[model samples]
Target: MSQRKVTMQVIADTVGVSKYVVSKTLNNKLGVSEATRQKILFTAKQLGYSKDGPSEGPSLPLETEIENGYILVVLPNYEYQSISYTYWGAVFQGISLHIQSKKAGMIVITSEMDLSKKVDVPNLIGIITVGTVDEQTLLALSTYNLPIVTLDHEARIIRADSIFMDNLGGIERMTDHLIGLGHKQLLFVGNIHYSQSFYERWIGFRNSLEKADIPLTQGNQKILTIPYDDNMEANLQQHFEELRIHSTDFPTAFVCANDHIARRMIVLLEQNGLACPTDISVTGFDSLEEDKHLSPALTTVQVLKQVMGRRAVDRLVWRAKNRDYPSEKILIVGDITFNESIDAPKKR
Candidate 1:
């Protein structure tokens, strides 16, 4: 049986654009926008269009090609945000190991680097971004029109598949755990505006409080909305000092946004002559490596960091096969690890 031939007209019709636009896009001409060009190319690939005729095989960006070609991993260019950090390091390891297992090449570049100037476009099959990437950087990556999958982040200006942990659920669970310990007065500690994940964690905290019939007071809101900056540490200390002066208003426990913040809070509490799980209980998210060796382990949510990176690779491969499909946001669920940090509130 003979199959119908795929043509530029077919792709143009699928993409709702003029045949002239499709022609220009396929030839890599200058008229069309990067987004439009990518759409046209994806549509053409989906329809099996080629210079020779409708191809029996998938397009250039396919599983086979992805295995043979290199995948580029983009990370934020911050001193503390690199792969050396506990969370990001695990994620990068997952990505590196998965790529190695697939016999595929992988190149990592920081967002600080100019994509067009640094990247060898022809040899690359796809891109996987680890953390927050600015719109300008995203736009630069878009010029290549490759399939992009982001881990623990999303792009505001471009279309890409996103993979994130169950931020809301994890925190909500942790908060519920704290509430179960009879800690009625709980304070959330984190700059809610720090990142999307952090903001969601704050929401989760509020959700749990609401569920427990706890009022969302202005005092609680103030702690969650701390300004993120160099002075934040000082501000946090000042808040602690005030809490000490007004012991009646102090929370029974501190629910921090992440492990680092939780650890910092514990230190500050000790400095203020308060003891963790005695005077005040504490909880943290992101069950990091350091939690194992600490005198009193941190109670935190176990984010599947490596799984995020590995699944990102899996998603890129999926994208390669289904370029014409709608973008997807993938969420991986994580479990909470109860440790020495959380306890019943001491009677005043």
Candidate 2:
């Protein structure tokens, strides 16, 4: 039979596979083994079948599947708008660049509508979750048994592929810097139990205090918490006001978890008639460029979010390629930015 006359049935018959398998392999629906996928594609090509009709065979975009299968970035309900939120945009940027380089298809799952409320993606290569998820979410995901890589989440119970910022080292260095500046009395801001990174940062803060012989006093840690709710500004103000009342005798400086907290600390402190680095010094993690807009500019830990994101993609693709490979975890460290927000404490 002429190569032009050969159909999917011919290729499936020759490869000893079903017609449906051959069709999915060609159209890229995803459940078949990679070896089987390759075999079907090879057979189909040899028999001269292409998406654009048989002729000289398939091109780069369509040798067998749709851009080498689908990789989904899930964030529960948050949409990726900009990298302004503690360097999340950088993470997205890194994922996009790497996936494009690999010539792969990528989709982000934020809500139920993306896949018609069905999380079942037969051809899913892997998943990279970018935000915090509850046990229910994790449980639902476990049912699929898809290759997963979690970013910025620190629930210790689940074992999966993950990448994390060096929260401990970064926060430790920031705390140590405050201590060195003659700021003996300092506070740790942000809720320590908010996420895994938050807890690690708290560990670093306590470690630094202990090393310096300073105590982690009862009221020194102010946990400013705001869940996924609409009244964040009001809640944040309330948290700060509650802290300010008890913070008078607390510290000369504050070690904030991330830039967002540091920025708020500065504003709230000013409202309470205190000035950063003058009355009280403050340092933060996640050296966001947008933070330059802050009056004194934030002194923070510089994070390589894009690098972390790229590393995650590397792990995800590798795991997908090697289905039986054990899960891997990657840790990325950061540097400190000694900006105007940190300085020697004011004289008593």
Q: Estimate each model's TM-score.
A: 0.79, 0.70
Alpha carbon lDDT of residue 68, candidate 2? Answer: 72
Off by over 4 Å in 2: 1-67, 81-86, 111-122, 155-158, 217-250, 322-325
In TM-score terms, which candidate is top? 1
Give lDDT tens digits, candidate 1, residues 200-313.
Answer: 899898899999999886655425456666676677888877666338668888999998888878887787888887888888888888767985788899998889888999
lDDT of 2 by residue, 1-348 (tens): 655566888888898999999889888897999999888877675566755667664422222232577787876565552555557777888887887888887877663333424565667777787867666666566556666788877545555787898899889888887888787877777666667888899889888889998865565543344542355456666766665534556468878777877787788778777788788888888877777876797888888878877888888766665444345667798888778988898777
After superposing candidate 1 on the true structure, give the runs of residues whose Cα lies further than 4 Å from its correct spot: 1-63, 78-83, 116-118, 219-222, 226-233
Model 1, residue pairs in steric clash: none
Q: CA lDDT, every prediction? A: 0.83, 0.74
